[model samples]
Target: MSERVEWDDLPADLRSAVEARTGKVVAAEGIADGLNCSTALIIETAYNGPLFLKGVRRTDEPGMAALRCEERINATVGGIGGVSPAIRHRFDAGGWTALAFGCISGRHADLGPGSQDLAAVAATLRRTHDLPVPDFPLPQFADRLRTFLRPGEAQILQGSHLLHTDTNPHNIMIGDGGGEAYLVDWAMPAIGPAWVDPACTAVRLMECGQPPEDALAWLGQFASWRRARPSAIRAFVDATCRHWTATVGDKSAEPSNSRFRRLLECGRTETA
Candidate 1:
């Protein structure tokens, strides 16, 4: 019988393949919670560079398909110059496929209006939104909104666009690529009208201790950049905030599925 393998327990074959393709040994140090998967920081010397290795369980969750889809999306967007570069590594072992990506440098900070960092993120978001969705049957925004609302959130998100389901502070990597910041993590990307992304960001800012006024102003900047309707934006923003307040339990605690819960709720709202 074949031995069961966990993601953290790197297979020698996978490690060898990575070194053969990238021409370097990956001494991967584990990083904290990458949603349902595991992420490791692969360090290589001689300018071979570091990579973030993400793996998913093919059996336990159906959402693993989304992760695979994300790998496809990243591969397509890699040539576009600003997206995360996910290099697929061949793995003959336990269904644990991996992608070697360039480590995005710089810090992931709390977003604020007029902050060069936040502006860069907003700009990058616009760039992504402009990309052709290409017959992508994304989940409906209104339905998701309804699913997420507490009691009155539905009335607010009557119409909205797709959202970057996980826009929390840690995911927004601020890099000096071409003197700009870049957005990462497309695993749980949500399909909403538009405000969904900013609203998520606003809730993250609030969780990070920013005042409601400040979070709103920051979200306004995101709205202006994305050219989304104010009503829709406010609705999603309120939903995200309410969801955060409920699911987060402690304001300072890191939110686990607040993003997913928000997306599901909003989608439910749209379908209703």
Candidate 2:
């Protein structure tokens, strides 16, 4: 679970810096989602209206790096249209580094099987794959999960596609009226095979109630998925399961882990 930050608790300098950029913050509401961000808020400003703010202490290197990377990606990934919110400003103030984005008035997507949001999610993933790979160093999926993969498995995960590795339903925002799905929380973005992200989403779909075959079937519509070798797909499943196993420790007690296990079992059964 994530924690919330109160307006009064924010450092005076940080608040003043943000206010200088967007005008006085009339209201600040904590957004109680996303695990990595230390402080996530939806603020209503006197002049800017509503804007989303995410900040982290400079002492937290990983968190700071994620925010910086997000700012960089948002700056470079052109033609994304409304698939993601634009960064309004990024600044360092007080003891923290913060980013402000055009606020998205949306709700978390319902990724359960048969949900109408699935189409929007699929479209977003396809658009993401279509995005031109940025000319900067990004963590390669193969290198990130190498320890959990077999000898040749990591190679299969390498590509130039920009990947949003964490696809938890909460990170997908369904537009309030347009019904479009915007992918948020670019903290774990990477460069990998086009199939990799949709494959990850397949596991998430399984977590939402779709059986392994059905989940995989849904992703099969993507050219990348259709072209992926069976061996590579199996490798990805095994590595993802191992990754989550290390993350949650005991699968039986953790709901996320349990769902990952189900996805692993499905892959194992199909591969066997």
Candidate 3:
């Protein structure tokens, strides 16, 4: 996420490799956002095109694996309904793995109450939820959340539905006219209940200053979320609270802790 590598940092051969596809790399700018990719960039080519690029050092197995998974998923769905950016090129050479994705022109989603972006975000997520799980191995949400989940709760969330686990506003792009919302960065896709994505988005909405009741009302549009077991929803809340509270240090926790307080109340309401 932080800026760890710049355009000039890539080896000459790797640069040339990218140039070959881009028709000469005329400009390169680093995009400092998420943490999974070692290098994130926006580059312009002599071909007069700008493309998004993400790369990982060859020696970083986990990083490379994440990118490869993204590449594969894009290969299958990136072209379908503009759900994600299409991969223009991908290659492994010069001790590096690079993927060039069609750069999207848009702004991050605004999850505030009554924001027009909400409808489009909701539609886009519905499309994402409907995508047929491509024939490939994906990690299970239950397994990922297992450590924090208490007895009986793990089983409650287990499902075959595909999930975009990371739906932070930064990752959701609202197109020029705000008619389209694209979910970018497929670094960590998981399989679980259909309600999982909706639940995650609800948290983001609240994080963006929307009240929990309004957030839940907005999310109620999703049938899966509406039909979800109250107990299951509570489990998701408890597990995520435990996970986030445990991971973030004290200084950063207070503000974040405040946000989840209302969400925790919403969770506990399920039990009451």
Candidate 4:
């Protein structure tokens, strides 16, 4: 997660553009849980109530592109029941591209072992797996990670199912009254096997104190998980561990590196 821009520091024209859609901005609070955006805030308008605003300067090509990708994914998945927030408005102005989503009065899911939120998380995964492939160009999950996988490992990553690759518990919002879990931040979506998202979730479960076997067991209810080939699972675990190891680099003492190491170890234990 990155520190975001303060509302007061936002460009006047961009603020105006957002306010145009939202009415007078009575209150704006920064949200500090996302990594790429230049700005992420919750705003309360005189008329529009509350909305979550996320934006990045056009100058940041990668960040800007991510925002646009999220917007597109939201639109495509918006009608697929209750998996994501509704996009209220999207616009570019003052050299910034931004989107406002209907605010979710929810908290980040607690993905630790035995947490009740796991059920909602599972349900969300089920609905997401059932969605038809979006009718737009998306990077193939296998192709995106081909360089990190062994010769035959990438084969299992190929499929038409839409995947939300970043399953950090923070990206999953559990409703205030224990309603449906909503997946947020759709920037890195991929088309892959339906099991990919749950596999990613399994990694996070390791982060949250479950061993790989227990984590996989927790997700056994998903048809995708039950039907996944053992080879594919091993490949996914190996490639993911390798990817994170490469990402964490020589800083083996770093906290993130330690977490990745645990996940890597879990994968090794399961497959050995």
lDDT for each candidate structure: 0.56, 0.79, 0.81, 0.80
lDDT of 3 by residue, 1-272 (tens): 43468889888888888887779887888887877788889898877398888999888898988898898788655965749889988867789899998888788899986788998998988888888886899988988878989999888888887788999988888878646999888989988999888778887898888988898778778888767777787787777777777799656665665555544444434544
Q: Which one wins on TM-score?
A: 3
The runs of at least 3 residues in candidate 2 whose Cα sits more than 4 Å from the true structure, single-residue gaps closed, are 1-3, 77-82, 250-272
The residue ranges of model 1 lying beyond 4 angstroms of the native Cα positions read: 1-8, 45-48, 75-79, 88-92, 112-116, 148-162, 176-179, 222-272
Model 4 local distance difference test score: 0.80
- Per-candidate TM-scores read 0.70, 0.89, 0.90, 0.89
**Model 4: runs farther than 4 Å from truth?**
1-3, 211-213, 250-272
Better of 2 and 3 by TM-score: 3
Say what the RMSD of model 4 is: 3.4
Question: lDDT for model 2, on a 0 to 1 scale?
Answer: 0.79
Worst 10 residues of 2 by lDDT: 263-272
TM-score-based ranking, best first?
A: 3, 4, 2, 1
